[model samples]
Target: MSASTPGHDDPVRPLPGWFDDAKLGVMITWGLYSVPAWAPLDDRLVRLLAEHGEGADRDRSYHAEADADGFDPIVTTSYSEWYQNSVSVPGSPTWHHHRETYGDRTYADFRDDFAAAVEQWSPEPWAQLCAAAGARYVVPLAKHHDGFLMWPSHTPNPHRPDWALERDVLGEFRDAAEARGMRFGIYYSGGIDWTFANLPILRADDVARAVPDSPEYAGYADAHWRELIERYRPAVLWNDIGYPSAAEPEKLFAHYREAVPDGVVNERFYAGTPDFLTPEYATRATSGGSKWETVRGVGLSFGYNRQEDASWTTSGPDLVELLMDVVSKGGNLLLGIGPDATGRISPEQDAALRELGAWLAVNGDAVYGSRSWRVAEDRTAEGLRVRYTERDGDLYATFLDRPSAGVSAPPRLAGAAHAECVWLGGDGTVGTVTGLAGLPVPPVRPGVPEPTVLRISPAPDPR
Candidate 1:
């Protein structure tokens, strides 16, 4: 297999088993963007034509907070100037909207807010909510491209506080989760950070552009990774944007092993291989046949998409079905939740989460600790049903679509002597399995279409 990142010529390390147990998680993304929750750049402009003409400052809060945080007020106030001059007018597709709205604010303001907000954040309730929603773990953004550290950090990011080093956000979150009996994880952006002049690596011309192998890159990596790993000791360390500019990932992995020997890492960090495979924005109905996870926000944006994009909102029922489908296929689901400026989850999002929790209370047993069945597909009474996993001698089958009424057929079964059928519901309800004596199965729709389970006993394995 390929080494982790480019030039990472080293032996691969073994992964841990707890990763298998972490089948579901909640990803939180909140930062400076959450302040104005800026609207889409193009569309918001037309809507703001009126405000702009009136000199109302389409982008407010430019330098007020930055000044308060002791940021370079003059340089910071010109952020909107830069956006208007460099991006919007020139069609540069810059994060013009983000810069215009929040560019002036320093990381200091966000840090104070984050620290205070996180302190008020009731991890107990949050973990309870996730557990209720059937999540095995919760992954919060430890650091984003903006370079703001959620936890205390003595080596502050010029713009934000060192709460990462002082307040111990990671420790508090971990303690909260353990107190609530749930696992904890973190998300870190690998290469970019607005505070770091070298950020926006894709832009290429932002800074002197040091390669990964350069001493500068090495120093940067060593410092950040060392602090995160040793301080947090996260169960899961998910990296975004990928690593390996000029340096080798083996060196980084070496640090990961030293700091968190048993922790699990995702593949986004320069290597498409980690403890599990990750699919963004959609659920995998089919088993990856390997350890995997599907990550996506409830809506189109991961963080607080101020516009409230309809595409990002996954209905409660849809969320439940998707989670069930993925788990049946032996894959995990990492759902994202966006928080507003006040650090509050949207009412709709919170309700959806609670609704998923309600469903999990009923059908989670059919999900947790389950193994995918050898057989991949089955013809059912409703239509075509896919067999995903097994739990306590029961076969769980998921219907791809709603079936028409009056159809009747027995789904194809894997090798088994006999079987009993039941729908996987909140209460353990069993339905009789009739008409399996022949082939050419019946329609699956009107005959309890969603996801149903079949109870089967296999012959004992010869020792």
Candidate 2:
């Protein structure tokens, strides 16, 4: 209830306990962009930024032709959700693809197709999938950068009349998620709306420069946020890009808190404080000792990309490892999934989510409601990666690789001579620290590469 400053050191409001305990969330990015669902299978945005600094500009010479090797981070962006902006850039693959496929068709033309596709979408399947994927929460995009609204809203887009959908997608999703005992959240692109300010956004600097500074846009975004909160009452308000300079996020946050007392806001609001920090495709060492969430797509693109296949995505084992790493470091993983315009999740993506859920079904004790241990990370004698987490007075040591015979226990666990060990999801028989040198290797499930979890009880005191 205290009014705190907007910075890492000070949060506007404390994060609810459910957020940290949730550990895993599924973010859905679907909109008009999914109608085309096309993006060059180039490197991910993070790799592109790392290869050519974020400030780097696109080559002008390649603006007239499609060069397979042409370099333009923004133009060739892997995020299909940025389709409108990418198609606006001349000569880029996305631009050329747009011209060739839908010649002379404006980006807004996809709205009709998107609407037709939505008629077939049922939020029930999505809710079921998230629940099956071991997601404690689900956040679906209400309004993406394309300025197209996914749900019917009372507050309409002034520039594009009736741009919103007729179906209450957000409300339907919220009801479905809540019915399944999962929290529901909303993602809104508050920074740049193509309808408000049509900037190609060809360069990194253009991202910020393109934010509509007009009072009209400020009021419009603010109204939309309020409407979403009033209608859906999401548990998480996940804003993307950045907020408008003209809007007062503090007032919005206050209103949101009043509406959803346990709700949390992401850091992208730009103006006011956030309940948690969001890092896209990156993770912080300690997250500055504040709660954080790592967001990344099942593949390179957050929006469905026709070009991406199984090879482009992280494997099931890798996904489990990523989750272990984040949770062990006191962070949550907000894994993203982009369904096509027809509301169909890709087979590869579906399989990966199921696989992750399968792993969680067995070893969830190490993840759910767990906190980072005193030693968050370490290496075993065999050089295999080990991550530690604590919950309910028990320590969990997750090994990235299957431990073999003679593989010594991690240094932290080596001293616990009286500790009792149990292989999670295995038989009820308990193992003890025989000599404080090595841990007994549990039988591995054939063909499954998921990380192994070991629960250890602390030594009893000599009373």
Please report the candidate that would top TM-score against the real structure.
2
In order, what is each prediction's RMSD in angstroms?
10.8, 5.6
Cα deviation in Å at residue 437, candidate 1?
A: 7.6
Candidate 2 has its poorest 10 consecutive residues by lDDT at 54-63
TM-score of model 2 (CA atoms): 0.91
Expressed as tens digits, the lDDT of each residue in 339-385 for candidate 2 is 99989999999888888888898899999999987777778777888
Please give each candidate's TM-score.
0.71, 0.91
lDDT of model 1, residue 206 = 26
Candidate 2 segments exceeding 4 Å error:
1-12, 43-70, 434-436, 446-449, 459-463
For model 1, residues 1-463, the per-residue Cα lDDT tens digits are: 0001222122144547566656678887765546544333233323322232212311121121222334322222222212211222222333455455567654345555555555455556566667766677888777765566666654555443353424555677678776766677888766545454443232222212322334554455456666777776777878764564544665666677677777777766655336665655434445544466767667545676566644346677678667766676667888888787556777678878877776566556656777766554455544555445666666655544443443344345433334454444423333333442332222333312244343333311111
Q: What would the TM-score be for candidate 1 when compared with the true structure?
A: 0.71
What is the model-wide C-alpha lDDT for candidate 1? 0.54
What do the candidate models score in CA lDDT, each in turn?
0.54, 0.79
